[model samples]
Target: MPERQDPFATLFDMQAEAMREMFGRFAGTVNDPAEADLGQWTEAAEQLRTMWLDFVQERMAGGGDPANPLDPAHWMQMAQGWARSAPFDPAAAQRMMADGMELWQNLAGAMLNTGGESAGEDDREKPALPRQDRRFSDPAWREHPAYLLLHQTYLMLADHFTRAAKEIDGVPEEQKGQLTLATQAMLDAMSPDNFIATNPAVLKRTVETSGQNLVKGMQHLIADLQRGQLTHTDAEAFTLGENLAATPGKVVHETPLYQLIQYNPATPDVLAVPLVIFPPWINRFYILDLTPAKSFIKWAVDQGLSVFVVSWKSADASTKDVVWDDYIRAQIDAIDHVRARLDVPAVHSIGYCVAGTTLAATLAILARRGEADKVASATFFTAQVDFEKAGELRSFIDGTQLEMIGKLSPDGYLDGRYMAATFNALRGKDLIWNYVVNNYLLGEDYPAFDLLHWNGDVTNLPAKWHGDYLRDLYRDNKLVVPDALEADGTPIDLARIETPAFVQAGRDDHIAPAESVWRTTRHFRGDTTFVLAGSGHIAGVVNPPAANKYQYWTGDSAAPSLEAFVEGAREHPGSWWPHWFEWLQQRDDARVPAKGKRKPGGRGDKVIEDAPGRYVKMR
Candidate 1:
């Protein structure tokens, strides 16, 4: 029997066959076959064959090295050897291919005399077509075909090496029983079950935290396949609970809030005390009201504060024209409507992430018109009023890139898909490469988790709003500086507002750097309290009662700024939820009868629902 060919070798053969077919098609396009230059055609064909043969030989030689086959110890040696012998070196293969293709086209044009005479003047005067845009254009590899070839080749070699390393490390070696036991102990500690029970949210986060590694491994085996899979899986897996509890025993609101209007007879009564929630459009609002034990909303309600959350609807193409002004106006209107219905005093507002910017804009707009009395207090959660030190993501959103993105979504709407991809890319080694190995190569099914599902539940931004935000906040650092922005031609100044304030910062947050959050404290003139919490962006904010493992530090003095507080404050080992609730309660007004008590309109009787709200349910 003939020797079985390697799967990759078969791919190479297919590529060669496709190239031959392309050549045949090019040859057939000649109008006058009799006038063709056989000499040039023959020479070009021979060169193509030689190039392919060299590529095959190099592949065989690299794989045949028995000493280094799938060995991590030999990674450096294998990389060096492969790099030295790369057959597809930049200048060698690409230049030759370009030159040969040009020569071949010229010969065809010469043979096809049908339009040559008529087009001679036009051809001479026409500027050379701009070089076709290439996929990879790093100048370092401009003249290095071998570098490109080896870059691709090493990906495959690396995957094999990684898998082999894992296998070797997992097995017991001679006279190493203790080492094996220690390794097993570590693996047990990191096992998904332990993480799942201790941190239910870890199921989804493990995938995100490890997504980069998965993508890298998958990219070598299947281009763009891993991204597609992740996108689909994430989009599909997102789910929000269908029930809500306004009070412990009075009423159990079990309707999908997204589909219902705020039409409680008590709407007028509850509206008296405005509860403004700033929910980032990036995900659903339930992160705050996650569960009864950990639900910020429940805690607020229990404290006799009338609470209202900004329930952001799923954005699609129709939301393209909704700019920053529209969102600010909607929020302001919602507050005003509540005020009208309740016949009560000004509202207290809480803003988070992107919502913080929106709230800042609203406050500025209100302050410009001398409507500051409407807002009683403002709380910011990992929100940055100043974007100058906005974290690692700042490096990516300079003017040029933002402009390009603006053009793509001119209405200022940012595509959620693009945003997801960018965040994934930032930590490609873990988020991407790991999944490629487990999901695609190893064919593992995605594990389940609510928080990850929420993280993946992305929403789009209006092109106009996205552009304005990037320009004003990120690129211009407008919100942090007085007179840095204007809404509807009215200037915004954060310092002029006298609303009491509370701000929280996460030490490990990559989205909003702690410094930026600290700088925002300077922008507030009200009685301000800033706290530092342990955890990343999402975890720090969504921390539930179950997460007793984490700790938060608090202080009374606003001197030395946020950075000083972070450095000096002692860790009070416990969930930060209780502390935050206490701070908020101090600012909350004492309970009176809801100004205009509204009767419930036929929902469920009093009952406790599962954690996560209706908006978070998977579609």
Candidate 2:
């Protein structure tokens, strides 16, 4: 007959169409945008019921359950019963039918004990059992039969869709990952918690507040729409150089692309070599210097390493024409300038995330120029030079998506909001739906979190810079290939960079998987040391020694795979900072006078205003 489309593709298309229609209606009613009504909500909910009913009926339809035709419980029960009575099994029929029957009977009994929610009818008055999910953690969700059944069914459907995506055969690996994420995003969006009618907590709050909570929620929603993204944190809570990125430092160097800040040393004497950190341009550099208490820059400076951080300018019309070559040249120029100004032969180098990828390239260029010693040592924090094992993000980059993204920026750059959205998609439940439920659904203020405030503080990417990164590094996997990529007309290779390198990654990092970070050891033909920290991307890297929160693991560097590395690794309690500090001491323990209260500027100029500078204050 006809070629069947992928289930995830069909599901995604339906979801997109549904969202478009829903938004269209919602937006059309927003003349006095803050004034929202339940009639419209009821209409949308009915549409949702119809849409979901059609989708579910197409998959499994038999006994019509009027209580909720969209409910998956009845269809799921029918499907389970069918599987138990199937004429053929994936394996031989011997003992399979008997096992299936026994399993089905047990499952049916369990269902009965739970009041048989499978029939799509439940007594709302009777108390229901508690279900454990952060979204459904509120007691009302567990105590009300309607809500308890709703959340449980949603969880079951989420699991079923997830497992279905995983089990789909013959799909390409990348496509499969895309399918899995897409299914999850859809399922999360369709969750009972996201809808006021379905969310018991939201409904309870609305009733208690006489519907004022929804009016407030509408106001918040309108404001967020105007801003063009979800509010993830208390926006008014933190300001750069006041409470956040407030480390004592001054701008020493400035370029069209970035401004370099040199922190006044905390110690009387510092290491012989200065530490220059190249943070990812995709975000503001202050992540390394969020606050004095949480600042890695402050920690490193206190450890006697003269610290300098490069604060990248958020790309706009001015830097829109910038490309990869300019970035490499600017970095080299910065390194050389620092060496010349400090009268030091070389400085210690560290790159975080994308900056690490480019730093490796810079090192390669230095190696190609026969000046490999320009960098005394290199450290990478959650940085991926090898993309073979790159995380869930890699799967999102394909020919079509890349091309579409290339056109998204009319101003010759990709907006930071898109990047933020993508990152949020990676952890939709936590990053997206969590905020939606709390801020919009429950009419609650976003919690005051410095890191989240930093997260919401996004930076745009130059089109060329953004494109080159996605294609060369992620999609093409060209960085590890010798001479496959070039910066400033020099074909560079990671293998050529023989500088002693230190790579640290979070074991649970979603953006850059530890396995991929570990693979950097193979590509860099240097005495590379790899360390695994206990958290995800930001926390793993920003982990301070004093806080002593998460643990890190150190292992034999010769271990071929991450699993092998972990197997032999010893777990140490607390942050990885101490281990890294010790590692830095091994290379250059020689002491020199710290650059104390001197004006943080170039060799000639008086000063570049103050620390945190003017650029960081830009939108």
Candidate 3:
């Protein structure tokens, strides 16, 4: 392995280069870089970049073989050459070469150890166990010589290629990311477990079913084709306004762009400051209101907080022209509507994911115009204001890529499937191939999970707004820089936001990495609470106190870095909801009668519709 380089020599230089490359790709012309299509290629490669598409294509050709086009070993051979070609890379080639030597030597040792072994042989002669992966969890993988050989061989190749792709030192960061994605996708798609011939469990299941599972698998494949993606859950098991978003509420205000649903208070008294939720239009709002037990909205109402949520209309021809400012304005409109309906000077607000990014901007606008008092406090869930650390999602955000995807959709709007594919590709192991093996290979039933159902219910984005948002946030990353971005003629400065804010991030969240989410403390001027939640984006925020499943951490919200924060933090059992509620109480615990009527946002005596209104039903 090579020694480290001096920070004075390359850290800043590399960052500058990466930034230039990212923005260059984003700002380039349609013909820019000839790789303008790289983003689209990466998106399509999500199937293979992340490993679903190539695996499917190979499977269509019948059982797995060494000559499979997407084999990890084949890609690993190419990837090793990439490492070796990095002339300026300090030790990248040396490290990879040494690693490869170690891998082969270890594998050879394992083979020699296992040479004369048969089933249930002496433990001393057995090979070293492969790394623990769910894919190799079947006992037969370790006990059966033939399967064990394939399993260990695949793991070694996967590790070698995955490492080489990740450490390729000479390429620009974006290109490196794409290559890494492509490499991993190949490895994932060509895993032994994915093949009927190589996987003991799958092969056993196939034989037991007398190949009837293949028939079931064909039917499942056709269903996935019709559904347009692998089934993550039993979609038929859940429905909105019933088993799903069943929280009691009424759609009291309606607009072509949004429906404002005001929840009926579960208690006789509710917080004086009404609570309005701003969910990202990228997903339906029902995510926060899953089943009653899992529903954040229902839980908040039960905690004596009056709740309202904005249900954004799915983008179509009517919404193609809605720009970034429009979303900011719509959020302000909702805040004002809540204040007017509840007869309160201010209300508390919550924004999740992308909506949270816009909310920070809205607060900046309000603060700039001396209207910051519109909201009493704010909370953000797994939201990112800076995109530099946004993880794999950033890989698909260059300028040409954005343009190419919208061109494939109506009125240049981004089809939800593209967004879906991008996200699914990020965690292909869990999101794509796991389901592929289970449903299409094993012919098993998909789990009936509310989260997966909501995940599948994706929303389209207006092309203008989509491109603008990604450009400013992901491409340019202007939000964290004061006044770097402007919305509706208001120069946005996040530091201008003086409202007390609570920022929660998932420790393992890939979309909005914890480090990125926590750094918002640097931007806001107000009192801020930063807590790290357990699990990924969805489970982290949607966790109900009753479930008591995951833990959270809090310490120096003012910590300079994530590691520093962890060093100073204390782990607390259960959800962060109670802590947030206590913070809200400290701000203003004043209570009002749950207003006794479900018509808080109603005009005179007319109710617009039931909760989870028409706008949410658009898809």
Candidate 4:
């Protein structure tokens, strides 16, 4: 074929020239060694050779071909193939990267000090080690003179190959028959006047003129490497099932009691007030019961308090009829059952996330009928009682979207995947783009972090409950105002709740923003303490004593207003775990042994084995 004056080819040639110039500049900056120091140079050269050989062999065997520039489609196909074949080998990748980083550090140190003649002999013999290899491998390392020319040459050819492959892939199957005719017609259609008139052609011309292929390539590669390293690192650093494993704590009468409970010594003997933990039904309760160091449950149990945690049941199609009211009823039933067995007059209740909202509603319903004696105190964690400022999720609950989802299920529940996708879209840079680049392009595995794994373990919401929740709370912000929401035909009034209250809000929470949690303080008429924790929703509530990096701000204002606490909070940097422990201790009533003779056949018969509660382990 005759030589084609391809614009893309010309651009590629220019990029090659620029790359050579940049490499030469970097090489010139390196200090030159004396002839007598050839031995040291030889050793460094041999190390470099070994590294390069290993990289080449690895790439040839399975990794991306260094001789091939990455085409999006080819890269995706190759990555998917690799993932299917080998999955994510996090351990192996971590080890390889670690070794590579050490080698690179040693090589750089040798060059930088040049035997440390300017410093003492001790310094020359033992150099301070580099920082732990936090960053991924820099592609720029290949710019050394020895590999520069060959690497560039390989990349150029690969680019051409990738471009050709992409063109072939983009062609419609039906149009393949008239390829030559279409090409000539395209040439006829692309006359300079037509190109100037046509927006598509004009846009094409602008891209060609920018001459940004190499910059784009480098950007793409950097993104790929970063994603790969993160995936590999996360996978190696975390384990989904393993991290969620329950650690054994003190057992009360053959039942596992989380270690966070405490009881006050100065209270009536008849009142056996236990802390009722209402963890979100979306995941297991063990996020609060993680490990002794991070375990809120464990900490509480150790405080000499009686603790009762709700173990949620998993739902299948059989449980489709279960509604929001059913959950509230179940919780109240648990309370009655616990009271009957323990002969407790009242219990302090702590609710987290969605469960917090449910418990708040339950309290309101009970209070409206003057039945407030059932509960002693109420606490919420990153929970929203006022949905007026429901944060980013507000945009998603428009009439049209609600109606569309309502049509899918007559009752109004949206699919769990839909919710997951929406949450994922919110942080597309970190969730979507990062995963795409890592798993699809870099052939890396997903991490096994406990929280992230829990996040991935999605559960379906009942259509009716979801629809009612979004429309009433999010769309209209009805929950906070008077007579806004009705439970089983009874209106919910927050002013009726007279129990002592504790509310915790995280500063960086995007899910239930701090403002939403803070608003709950306005409704409570009794003693209240508002705490500002120093992490996101999950991390803040799951704040174990071991996570000492956290800080908290608490205010003296028992004011009936959220704004008053905002003014009172002075910034204090340290773990909030100790403060919460102390605060809960003050509120806890004195514990009493089970008043009546122990009932032989109580709720314990139905209790499942001590694993993560069913809802959490489902996925």
Candidate 5:
């Protein structure tokens, strides 16, 4: 690789650009000859200095920890400002107030109805009143009128606040996204569950445990503090090769960029066309091959499909200068290796999350070079090619935050743990505080959840590659626009992709909203099947038919908009996996006997070790 440019310098340049946008002039030295206001600049500098001093003084007064000077209260105040600035809806507010009053009245009536006497066996067995919101469902909470009032009022106000934020008119899309994120974050923080006094369950547990819960919780807190971070999982409970990534596979191919793990086939006959999967490098590829029960790779092998997965090397100082081209090359190299080993003309391909986006780009590059036929079929799982409405995650992608993070990095690579923490902030109540309460306050061990264990295994983002990805895909959205993104000296276009396409989106995926995924259908001018799966991002994709869980939606017609498509789509009873496989079986040729061993000099590249390669074990 060429000499790496200083990320700090790039960050400084980005910061300067933002400052120029804000102040209408550059700082330090004014270069613009058109306008110069020395007096105004001096006054602004003084004001900025005063503001900084006030912030520092406030932190000192609050008994600053130095590490976490910005207390919860300070963030709450910022949230208040964001909420207050959102557009006001008087009618919505009035309805919320009226509902709050009615809720209080009903709670009082319910309390009176219970009376002073203890309930009989039948009465005790009776179910609590039905509530649409699951967060407020508890018999103890239902019995308390004050608790109900507070909960109902908070819910009512939060509902209106969300609506009001969406109703904000004449704001830039980025500003509107920030407001939506701000409002959501504030509401999540103010949840009744967060407070011991308001949460009947936590309070009851505290009393029942005789304050031992608090003591245990404090211990958990102290342990995390000593580590200088939050504990994501009970790491001691699960081992990678043993319990987590236990799928049977061989490392048939390896590159500096990725490891191609080829799973042992469960069937004697496999599909004529082999399958290759490109998973997001942000996390371990084991999410797809987490365990035998949930592993998609294992399922694919069982279903008589030869599977190959690209396990991207976790970024480090040596790989920090790796660019997007390197990732694309890995995908291409893996595909060639699979094709060569299987001796197939073309192979079926799948991409998940960021990997999907990369795959799409790779396909475009191939299509431009008249090699599109290399991939017989393409499938994207919860991936966005067009990010016009990329959801709440986009709120943190502003140039300012990106630059700050870039400058703060001691190494050229961005820390995976820090990125993981940012994602936790998006759903703080569930990801962060739930653990804080269960592990720290209650002094209880978190259950051995395979998914959570897999989640804790994160991979760092190459500073240069990740920067390109965020700016091009999320910031500029160059993929959808023709000739905007160039790969391998060719301007790749999404429209050029006319292969049989299957796009799957999760209904409740906050990270990559279903609507954003749906938009990709418009870009592909081929036989496109868009399936709307139920549940959040990871769970929705990992869902197996055996689970008898989350339903999916399919449409005979591709409606212009997501709303119309959803309304017209027919609901299916089980996992979307079966639906996708059914579609895959048709496109794939007749089955052939599986090869007992991989081809010698597979794709003309040397085989490294067995599956779940050494690179994956890198910290």
Candidate 6:
């Protein structure tokens, strides 16, 4: 009854108890039904505030006034120091330390055993060691125990954070995803590579530059702040109509939704069926016609195919009422215009990214309404009709995030810049930090890259259309389900689509996962050929044969489970363009020699403007 607790133990217990109480209060606020309007961010903000205050108090014992301690930059610096204050869970850290010790012991034993021994046959034949992670590749860091310790500690913490986030109980899926993302982002930001203290390369650079890199980095940061966005590439280096979207074409037709550009025939003989393209409106249409070397439009035109491209108008407050049906109607109108202009029985159709989903829906509706004959065949590039495996981007489209986005778009149109920023975050290391370091840290100019330039040229999404897309396709997943989606007063059934299909999936695509794109084959009853390209979404589609780069995989002339397909497939070097062109030719009617007398616009009355039209050039 009179047993007294040790004062040191009692003090530590009291401190731990205080922390638990604080966390309990924060968790209660999160779980409270009354705070539902605030969503999961309330707790995140509260935790961040607590962390910030603790960090400031700990660091500024003899400090001057902490001006704007809540500043994001200050918070970032504080977060980087969090590991020094016990960032990892105690249990997880103990386990990691034990494993690390065992590894160290094995390494010491190996070093002890290797003493002037001649290489044996088995040693010589040994397979090369697995490639090291880029962050740990530098040999200079291996010479120092402190550097090694920092690297190992950060990696161990990263692993534990990922595992802990997945094991978190009673968290909403979206919240869990956000937590995992945040954890990884923190670990990446705090990585040894980012600092001079832990990174030998950075230390050497600092020594050589006499700390000028820091000054240059500061100047770069100031410039970026003034610009209000991160610049990844030099946009001034590339002009839309001159160097990019340079494929020669004229706008033959225009609608509220899009401008139709029929390109000049490069080959004397053109296919009887014209190819009508539906490009995703989220970005500018120039991705398909980025450059002479990678331009799909140029390749198609050069292959004796008459080509027409749909360049969607960037949405504005005036076009806020535009919806899914409006896009479908515009597509139908474009196809009709192409058929009328070229005087063909049917037109070949191709869709890229979001356009592919819309095109599939349009074709399905057309099939239902007995208008399927308008499209001769269909090809999709890096598109998915099914959204089940839509990858990491899906997490940002949940109810909470969607609502937040809607609130931000007061003018009834989602800002294109915001969309671009989100995409940049998906691969922040390559798309963001590297640029940050190059432009700011190293005081270097952004390079002139066609792809990066195209990436920066984004377009707005009409509020109604964007909302419908997120709710219908992503949230409700109604596209694949029969009668769940209707356009032009007709219900759609993908099984009714009789158009021969060519579906291309990128093996490394994180946006539309390969399996997600491969599933489209089952929806079409007509012949389908699915090819798995060997890169991410953009590079895979823009692959040129001359590059002699990334290989593609093809199997038993049919679509199957992605795993089975890849397993049974044989790898082929170079691009998939030639294979796709051959497939198109097989189904196309006889080619006819081009008549120079007939320009791009068949009847001049329907012509609106030139290629790379007003819509594309619009801000």
Each candidate's TM vs. the true structure? 0.58, 0.81, 0.82, 0.59, 0.80, 0.79
Q: Mind giving the per-residue lDDT tens digits that candidate 1 earns over 1-619?
A: 3343333334344334433433443345542445656665465446545655664586587663332112223323322332232222343445445554453344323323222223234334532222321222332111122222222333333333333323343233321222222233233223222222222122233233333322332333332332222422333443344333222222223222221123222222332345767688676676675445656676665545566665665555667676666677767876675566446668788889888877877887787788888887787889988887776566445554565566556434565655665565444444544454355433345655555555555666567777777777786787867776676777788887677777888888878877888777777677777888888677777776565757788875476766567667878876787777666557653555543332322343232232333444433
What lDDT is obtained when candidate 6 is compared to the true structure? 0.73
Q: lDDT of model 6 at residue 6?
A: 36
Off by over 4 Å in 3: 1-128, 596-604
> Would you give me the overall lDDT of model 2?
0.75
**Model 6: how far residue 223 lies from native, Å:** 3.3
For each candidate, how many residue pairs have backbone atoms clashing (under 3 Å)?
A: 47, 0, 3, 17, 4, 1
CA error at residue 562 for candidate 5, angstroms: 3.4
lDDT of 4 by residue, 1-619 (tens): 3333332234345345534544334334442312234454455446545655665576667766321212234233322332232223355456545554444344433433352223234334543333211111233322222222222233333333333322443344322212322232222223221221112222222233221322333334454343332222243454423454354321122212121211112212323567778887665566776544776765665554566667564444445566667766766766666666466677788889888988888888888877788888888888888887667566456565567556545433344544555565455445545454344333334555566655654555666677777788777877778777677667888888888788899988888898888888877777778888888888877776665677888886565555677677787766676776567667664555532222122344333333343344453
Per-residue accuracy of model 3 over 424-497 as CA lDDT, tens digit each? 87788888889888887788977898889998887888888888888889888999888888989999999899
TM-score of 2: 0.81
**Over 4 Å off, model 4:** 1-245, 248-271, 407-414, 558-564, 592-608, 613-615
How far residue 366's Cα lies from its native spot in candidate 5, in Å, is 0.7
Q: Model 1: what TM-score?
A: 0.58
Q: What digit string (tens of lDDT, one per residue) describes model 2 on residues 303-382?
A: 88788888888888888789988888878988987887688899999999999988999999999999999899999999
Among the numbered candidates, top TM-score falls to: 3
lDDT of each prediction vs. the true structure?
A: 0.53, 0.75, 0.77, 0.54, 0.74, 0.73
- The worst-scoring run of ten residues by lDDT in candidate 2 lies at 80-89
**143, model 3: CA deviation in Å?**
4.4
Off by over 4 Å in 1: 1-239, 243-274, 291-294, 302-304, 410-412, 593-619
